[model samples]
Target: MIPNSGIAITIDIGDEHFIHAPKKKEVADRLLFNALNQTYGYNTVDYAAPIFNSQEKKNGGIVLKFKNAETGLYSYEKLNGFEIAGEDKVFYPAKAKIVGRKDVFVISDDVPNPVAVRYAWRNWVVGTLYNAMLLPTSSFRTDNWDDAIKAKK
Candidate 1:
């Protein structure tokens, strides 16, 4: 599980022993350094991916604010994997951009009165949002309401 605090890593040893991979030590070392730098407060390291902070409705879209994006927020190429939903509880793909240091503006022509937003909410999602530190953003949803994606089917 991904914790709110601490660091994480992905490892694959195939059919070999757990620590047999040549890169295992390297990966573990990196993870330890990140934990010490980011979690232990060794000069503000942006270790984990950005998580949802807050959001507000703007003129035609929603402005999403983040906390762990101290350096700034970013996206790979153009923004993707964002969706906006209205009171009808239906969601549509949205156009999003980093507006400032830690804010992102998401808009969807299909969702005029958007009441909720979600990012990388799919099981097979390829996350695009990132912080200035180059870490990817975690999957998040704005509300606890029923999932619009599930309702579609």
Candidate 2:
């Protein structure tokens, strides 16, 4: 940070007097901005992308669909943490997929059969949802799964 041109508000606390000035970015920020500019296809990656559903109806309510602003789901290896729910609202973690362009199908693995599925249910989870490029997938919750917050709380 630099001092304001000519006159400005100045104050002295305990250690030293402070002068208002034009804000300047730190080196780390400059480095990141530079990296983003130089990095290959940076726009294609989203760290915390948002997920929105399409109003157009499809196969059925089961046809829960959304768009990944990015090209595709990132897969350092394989994406995971998909889960399912029945009418009872029981959520059991299951397998998932990136079909076609943006649709992700969360299959009922443990439950064998299911009605609805949720992805990345945990808050502040490290990583799970992402395009094949490893960009973080949008955070979401499938069901108010019974006891969803109860157990965690």
Candidate 3:
């Protein structure tokens, strides 16, 4: 996500030098800008590095290490759409928990040797993961697979 992408606005008008409530249009404009920024993947802070390597654990899970996560990891209070995939299976809903450290997440699924993971990877997705500053994590995937939309067409 780019800096200054998160939308918040302030407007000054009229000659009154006193504090006043925000106008409806001002509120609406702020909402619209924020919604658009999120929709365009410009309002969130995502991983600083790609998932270059994955380590399989004895418990049938994989460990993923992320950079730029020193701020701590958190999930949105109500949203969940994390997934994992193996060579033989497609991406399926899975569970991920921050383990050992703030930047290390362990993803567990039924598949053996999980090869890839993804989060909020959809057109209408709203971010489910956030950093300590409450910035959302942009949609991301670890696989280099062909674009699903283009493949379908």
Candidate 4:
């Protein structure tokens, strides 16, 4: 059962998010569940907790933005793990960091004038968000483009 707190297992860790992957019993086990069985009664909540997500594309220049990852937690340092693709249709982790409360900035460092931005859009994406109460939101992405670039071997 997915918890409402928005915490999940993935590779990316956002600004105000916490994780305990090493504690998971199985690959499918969620990180939050680790806190449940190992910590206090975390699973007691049967309903969806509040969720916050980041927003993107209010403007241009491949600006990365988040509506909410989970919640309370904010950014510390520049979070790596952003990828941008130009006309080449290649996706590679670009340089990324929290620019402000309403935006994140990303540069391809390889491609200039990038048009679209992508966060941890992967099903296993690791991201962050915060609620109004300052709690972590959850990992999410902005672009759902059907033509997303797949990594080449």
Let me know the TM-score candidate 2 reaches against the reference structure.
0.51
N/CA/C clash count, model 1: 0
Best model per TM-score? 1
Per-residue error at 49 for model 4, in Å? Answer: 9.6
| Alpha-carbon lDDT, every model | 0.74, 0.46, 0.53, 0.49
lDDT of 1 by residue, 46-153 (tens): 465577889999988999998778788876588888889988888788899989668999998888899899887775555677778666676789978864653352
Clash count per candidate: 0, 9, 0, 27
Least accurate 10 contiguous residues by lDDT in model 4: 45-54
Please provide the root mean square deviation of candidate 1 (C-alpha atoms, Å): 5.6
Model 2 vs truth, CA RMSD: 13.1
Superposition-based RMSD of candidate 4 using all C-alpha atoms, in angstroms: 7.8
Ranking by lDDT: 1, 3, 4, 2
lDDT of 3 at 110: 58
TM-score of each: 0.76, 0.51, 0.54, 0.48
Model 3: per-residue Cα lDDT over 8-60, one tens digit each: 32322112354442455754565565665565565553323222234445367
